[model samples]
Structure formats: structure tokens, C-alpha cells
Target: MTKLLFLVADGMGDWPVAELGGRTPLEAAPTPNMDALARRCVAGTARTVPQGMAPGSDVANMSLMGFDPAAHHTGRGPIEAAAQGLELDPDDLVWRLNLVRVAGHGPGDAMLDYSSGHIDTGRSTPLVEDLQAHLGDAVFSFVPGIQYRHLLVQRGGARAPEAALDIRPPHDITGQPQGPDLERFASSPRLAELRRAAARRLEAPANTTQANAIWPWGQGRPLLLPAFRQTFGLRGAVVSAVDLVRGLGRASGMEVAEVPGATGLLDTNYQGKVDAALEFLARGGDFVFLHVEAPDECGHSGVTADKVEAVRRFDERIVGPVVRALQGEDAALLLTCDHFTPLARRTHTPDPVPFLLHHPRLADHALPAFSEAGAAATGLTLERGHDLLPHVLERLRG
Candidate 1:
């Protein structure tokens, strides 16, 4: 049986930028390895984010992994909670509490930084501990996760209709005034109190560029889904640095492989992840999903050059090594992004992303490049992202 590799470069899609002379980051980057792979593969566009759904990584990744987001996605909170090993009851409501920075004390203050300047785990962990000590009670609890990303669980709160509060992701409103949203949350005396206390307690003297507030959003209950192996008839593993991906892997009954230096940043251990994926396949695994988040972070920060460099690194470090390792092997490789985190908007867009499917037994398509424009030029597109996985599997088995 042939092995399969599904590689996701998060937020790799981008709109044309004036700074790069009308070329998107993926097009502008010098990704010779990816371009070469395109020549020997079938390339096309796929809509990962379904209609009327928010363009979040949770939804897009679910679709990419062959799970229908409309049916499988509960929310991001439950996924991250699973990653932290926190079990949730049917009536429990979980929220993703992000350490964010606001400009002023008033409600009209702008959301200055969503990830609290991407604060290190060492500093953010203590702040979460302080919140747990001060704000946690019989009804609510705070659990520390990775840097800036944490969880807040309201036990049995899902039984209340009010638990379905309208919450916005802080990253979606960066540099925008939070007056309306803050005022709405403040209408609840309990939430207001927690917000005020968190602001005061998070103020550390050593923290100059860190967060002073906790922005909670993406609330939902736990989800139960069929195992990946059961659904696809292939034992697989997931290699990613982000908790969301790992949690999805866990929930889908796939092994989650953690790399030592996989920080989900530009400095993440690319070689470590590559090694892990190849090792899993060598050890009788039928499939492996590898994800990288550096391009997404760069898109969120609106850094054009960094986004370009990130794509280059992904091609050189991850894709190149994996291709070289599988030179004499019977394996298949699928490369694509979940969604478009355009630098122009500094947020995710519900746009189709390019995908390349390469297999050693397949004939070369002789494509010119592996990019948005290049894929669009092919005029081949997959209307639904979930269909791509099954199609790849069918082709691989053939």
C-alpha cells in the first residue's frame, strides 16, 4: 500500500499586494521546490470554508481533513479544550480566552493586539494562573493553553440560553474600537466583573508589550465524531504545532505527533516536523497530515516580506525534505492551504485556495507553477474542499 502525506501551509493564500508589484505572497516567494512539484502534479483550486460560515482555521481545517464543517464543527473552544486534556460535559460551555491588548481603559478603546504581541508561554502561563486563582469558582474555570490561547469553561452553562452570547474574535477586530462589544458583555454583571479583575491582575511590571485584558470568544460545547481511520479506512497521524490541529487530530482518532521546537511560529522546528511525518509513514502509518502556521501569523501581522519568506521556508525546509525522502518510495503528497489570510485585510477570507496532488506512480502534468494565479489559470477547481481528500485517496489507490 502507498503512503499518503497531506501538508497544510496555514494562511498561505494572499491577495495581490502593491508592495510586491501586484504579486501575492505565494507568487512572490521563491518556492522552487513547490513549483517543481507542481510540474509533476495535478493543481487546482478548492473552497475550504463553506458558505455562510466564518473563515476560521477550525472550520477550514475540518473541511480539509474530509470532515464536513457544517456537521462536525462545534466551535474552536471545545477543540482547544480537548487539546488541553480537559473533558467537557454535554451541558458545559467552553470559550477560547485570548490574552489581548487594548489601547485605553474605556469601552471605546481599540483592540491593539490580539495575541498580546504573541506573548511567550512563560509570561502568559502565570497570567492564566492568576486568573484561575482570582476568577475561577464552582461555576467557571480557567485553563492555561499555549501562548495567548487559553480556555474558559462554564460548567453546565450551555443549559442556559444566555450562554449563546454573541462573541467576536479579537483578531477579527484588531485596531478597531471595542466599545459596542465590550459594552454588550458588560451588560452581564458577572462577566463585567471578571473582565475588570482580569485587566487589573494581568498588569505585570515586567510586561511592557504584553496584554492587559482577556478576550473570550468562540464558545461551544464538546463534539463527538467518527474516527479518521473508521471513516477513511486508513490509519493516520497529525503533525502540527498548533493546539487546534492537534485537538482535531485527537478527536478524529488520529495520533498527534508533537515536535520539540514546533512553536507554530516562523522559528518553529520544520525539520523536526518533517522527520516526524516520515517516521510515522515508515512505521506502517498509511497517512499523515502536516501543518505549518508561520505564514498565517505573518498574514495576521500584515508583514508582506515576512509572509513571502515564510512561504519560501516552508518550500525549502518542509516540502523539499519530504520530497527527497520519498524519492524511492510509493507515496502521495497533497499540498494546500486552509484559507486566505490576505495581508490586505489582515484577516481570513472565504476564498478558494490552490492545491497540488502529487504521487510517484502518477504521470506528470507539466504545470508551470504551484500558486494561486497558476492554479486559477488551469481552470480546474473543486467546489467543495471535503471532496478533495476522498478523490486523492481514490487516485492514490488506483
Candidate 2:
């Protein structure tokens, strides 16, 4: 049997920037390990986002994990809720309530920060608790999650005119006026009232990232997924610091590995995640899905150098160690990004991202490096991201 190691560098793809002489962050970063692997691995591009779908991490990730988003994804809210062990009723409505920083108390103000300065869990928890205490009742409840991400669920089959509302992801509209989006939901009196109440009650404490309001989007009911083992005929494990990834793993019947000091940030515990992936494989697991979120966060902040640094760190700290450990072992390793989080746009795009698949038995068709430019130059592209897994399986078993 061929052991599998699937690694994902979230939002690592970027557009060319003038500062880097028109090279994307991945191209600019000095990723020697990735470059070496590219020399011996199959390099190509894969379109993780389907047509007409939002290029959010949830949709992209689902596609990367070999599930067709159109067939399986309900919404991000339900997937995140699943990560927190929250069971949803058939009629329960779950929405992702992001702690955000707006310019003013009124909706007319611009969204200053989508993640409320990437609010720490300690500071954001109290606010979520307070909201639950003050605003939560029989119909609505607030559930705290990692950092700025949280959940708001509406029970009793109370629909909130979601179809009529123009709710948008806070990250997608950062630095833009939010009044128009808020006004679109004015038809739903209950939602409007809840929004005002949340804004009035939540205030950021001094000297901390300002999480002054809750921006709700990505609403949906719960969903069920076919087990990963049944779908792929391989027992799998998932390692990630983010809830959405962990939730997807749990929902798909994969073991969710937790690593200490894993913060899902630039300073996250890269060694710990590497250790977990190796440990899972050592324990007779068939596959491991390791995800790193730092690159995407850096892209969202529009920091080019930081994004480059993130890619380098992923290449050195995570990919290098895993590649070294797999030496002399019958394993197939795959490294790729789910989608492009371009620093220029400071948001996700539906463009195809680069992927590298390596196996000891296969011949090397080396490239100069594993990057957007190099991958595109190869002209080997997977039109659908979901096809990647099947392709990997074929290479492993062929």
C-alpha cells in the first residue's frame, strides 16, 4: 500500500506585484525545498474553485479534499459549527459571525478590519460569552470559536429572509462601506434588530484589536458527507488549526489530529504539525491531510513580504521535514494550495493554483521551481480540483 501525505498551503498563490519586479509572492519567496521537490515531482495547476461558486476557503478546500463542492458543500457556517461539536436540527439556521472592526457605530461606515485585527481567542471569547448572556434566547444562540470566527444559530424554524439579504463576507469587503449591504437585509426586521443589538452590545476593550461588531454571513443548514474511507478506500487523518478544516475532517469520518502551539498564524507550531502528520502515518494511517493557514492570513492583510515569508516557512519547516522523513519509505507526497489569495486584491480569486506530486517510483520531469509561473509553463492543468485526489490514487496504485 502507498502511504499518502497531502499538504495544503492556504492562500499561497498571489498575483505578480510591482515591488517584486512583477513576480508573485510564491515566485519571490526563496523556497529551496519546494524548488528541489519540483525538480523531482509532477508539477501542474488545478482549478480549485468551480464556476459560479464563491472563491472562499470552504468551497476551495472541499474541492481540494476530493469532494465536489456542488454536490457536498452546504455552506461554511454549518461546516464550522460541526467543528465545534454543535449538532444542528433540520430547520436550524447557522451563520458565521465574524468579529470585525468598523469605522463607526452606524452601518454607513466602512469595514476597517474583517478579522478585528485577528482578535485573540482570550479577548474574543468574553465578547462571545457576553453576547450569549445578553442577546441569546430561545430562538437565537451564539457559540464561540477560534479567534474572530464564531457561530450564530437560529432555531424554531425561524427563517431570516436570507434570500432577500445581500450578506457578504467581511474579508471580501474590507475597507469598503457596509451600509448598502446592511440595508439589503432591512426587509428582515428580525435580522436587522439582531444586527443593531449586536453592534450596541459588543465593544472592543482598550489596547486590543477592535472587535466592535459582528458581521454575519455564510448561512446554511447542516449537511452530511460520505465517509472519506468509503469515498477513497483509504483511511485518512486531518491536521489543521482552523475549525473549518477540522470540521470537514470530522464530518467526513477522518481522524482530526491536534497539535500543541498550533495557532493558525505566522508564529504557529510548524514542527508540531509535521510531527503529527508523521505520527499519524506511523500509526498505520493510509493518508494525512495537513493544512497551514498562515499564508492566507498574510495575503488577506495585503502584506507581500509577510506572504513570501509564510511560503518560505511552510517550505522549510513543514515540507522539508516531511520530505526528509519519508525518504526510503513507500509514500506519495502532494503539496498544493487550495486557491489564490492575491495580495493585490487582498481576497480570494478563482484562479487555478499550483500542485506538486512526488513518488519515488515515478520519473522526474523537473522544473526550475514549484511556482505559479513554472506550473503554468508546464501546460499540465487539472480543470477540476476534485480530480486531483483520483489522479493521485491512480499514480499510487498504477
Candidate 3:
């Protein structure tokens, strides 16, 4: 039987507002189409693993892909770096850099938000080039992305384990405790020294610019793991606009297909995204993971309308096509979010997310159409993220 799993990690905080006390964009927004699908499927909420702790995109995605995050999780820096086309050596260490405004103000002014807001890649690329000139390929190398984001690669030499030592927090946003411990920094020293130097340069009023702010985050390297094909015994593919998701898919022995003309914005190529998934499925992929960034980006900006609109647009454009592809075929379709990117909170919510499964031979067309409110009433009950894969596999067998 052909099996397709269309997973939407609909960005942070995308659940219904009513369910989470009116704090999420997903609740406040209109998603008539998604609501309709929930009606005819086995719907329920799935709790993300490890409980209460804040995990990066890599950990969260690994959980949804049916790998135990605790066992397979390495870090987000490596994942994002990979997505950005940075290669890694087992001896090398990679760190994610954020383009942040290094303001010398009081605690309130100390951190100005909009630090390289959006993918202002134009401003970011120049800043990266400047930094590269300063480093000059010594023990450390600087890699740049759009404004406020970059990657620092440390050449493995005499700095084997020590290369990872003596680092400091890149930003005050995480409220990292004030300390001199190198071990406390997110990444190793080769990258940490470069970050500190860059921050100092940006701290000077003359060096800072509206879109040239620097802030680095999500630090780690490619973790060794059994290929997804070997572990699950299933041929799979991943389609996404996120670099980290794509990089991880590539590392795990799966085809990371690109959606033509896809952009990481509200105006992304939705039809093209669906078409790519269909193509991958036709090419013999039994497991397919699709990612959308609309809701998440809105949450980051705290934009309620954009978040809601993104979700609706995703449903109308992405969902319909995927569902249509599965109809009358010997296949199973499952839908869900990775984590909640609530607009109200402007961060990821620990709340369990709603998911549904539909098999063609099932006896219930009486189920309601997909919607957040209807999913809550499906009587499917809630479980943790780790159980999602097993549950979907069972439905595929039926």
C-alpha cells in the first residue's frame, strides 16, 4: 500500500486560541479547510517529547519523524548549518550566528528587537564578508547568511575538545546567566571568540546598522545516526522551505526535494510545494514530511493577522492537493503540527498539538471537516509526540 504522511510543523504557536485560553494565532485565525479534514479523520492531540523544556527545531523535527529525540538529538546549530549548505567534519564544530543589534543601553535598551528582522539577506551578506576578512582562515572560519544570521566553523587542530571550550552566550535574550565559564557558551571557543569580537565591533555605534545586527544561536554539529531508511525500513522524502529541515533530511539518507519558486514568506509557492510532494510520492516514497513556515514567522513578529492568514492559505492551497492525491488510492494520510508557535505568547507553547489519520477503506465519512474546533471534539484523545509514528504506521497497515 502507498502511505503518505503530510506533516505540518506550522511554525510556533499555531493552535486555536480558544483551546489555549485565547493566546494562539491558530485558534483566532480561520482555517475552514483544515477544520473540514479533521472531521473525517481520527483526530487527537500529540504532546511533544521531554516535557516543559525548550527544544530547538532539530529536536522537535526528529521527534515528529519517529526518532526518539532523547536518543537521536544532537543540536540545532549543526542542523541549520547543514540546511544553509555548510558542510561538517567530525573534527569540526559549527555554530549558528544571529545578526543582532549590539546596543550598549540599560537592560531595557540593552536588547533591541528587529535585530536583522526578516530575511534581510542583502544586509547580512556584507556583514558576513567583513567578518570573513577579519578571520582570514586561521583556526576559525566565518560563514555568512542573511542579516542577523551566520555560521562559524572552527578548523579541528590542536583544538580538538578544547576548541569547544571557553565560550560565552551570544545574546542576552535567552537570559543566559552572567558568567565567565567557557563551558556555558552555546558553541566551542573557536567560534565563541569570533562572536565576541564581532559583537564588540557591532557595539560601536558607527558599525551597527538597521539590518546588520548580529546574533548567533542554535549551536551543534551533525550527529551520527542510523539512516532513516535503515531504522524505519521505509522509503521517505522531506519537502520544506526551512534549511535545517532540508539539511537533516539529506543527512538522514532521504531525498530532500525542493519546491520550485518557493519562498520563506507569506507569498510562498503553495501549489508548487504540493506538486513537489506528489512528485516525490510518485517516485516511490512511502513517507513524506512537508513543512510550512508561515505561521511560525508570524509568531516571531507577533503578527496575529499574518499568522491566521498563513494557516488558511496553507489549508486552501497545500492541504487540498495532498488530500486529493490520496483519494481512492491504497494509501493513508496523516496531518498534524510539530509544535505550537502561538502569536499571543510569541514563542513555542508546550501544549499538545492536534493530529488526524484517514484511511480510504474506513467506514466514517460522517466525520466533520477539518477545523481546530472540530479536532477538539473528535474523541481521539491526546498522546505524546513519540507515539505519533507508531499510530500512523498502524493506520497505514489497515
On lDDT, the leading prediction is 1
Off by over 4 Å in 2: 156-160, 204-209
| lDDT of each candidate versus the true structure | 0.88, 0.87, 0.63
How big is the positional error of residue 99 in model 1, measured in Å on the Cα after superposition? 0.5
After superposition of all CA atoms, the RMSD between model 3 and the true structure is 4.2
User: For candidate 1, what's the RMSD?
Assistant: 1.4
For 270-373, candidate 1 gives per-residue lDDT tens digits of 99999999999988999999999999999999989999999999999999999999998888889999999999999999899999998756654667788898
- TM-score of structure candidate 2: 0.97
- Residue 275 displacement in candidate 3 (angstroms): 1.5
Tens-digit per-residue lDDT, 1-398, candidate 2: 99999999999998889999999988898888888888887878899999999999999988888999999887888899888779778778888899998998566689999888888898889888888998999978999998999999888432545633548899998888887777865767777788788887875344255887888788887857789999999999999999899989998999999898888899999999999999998999999999999999999999888999999999999999998999999998899999999998999999998999888776546887888888877788899999999988988798
Give the clashing residue pairs of candidate 1, or none.
none
Score residue 227 of candidate 1 by CA lDDT: 93
Which residue segments of model 1 deviate by more than 4 Å? 204-209
Superposed on all Cα atoms, the candidates' RMSDs to the truth, in angstroms, are 1.4, 1.6, 4.2
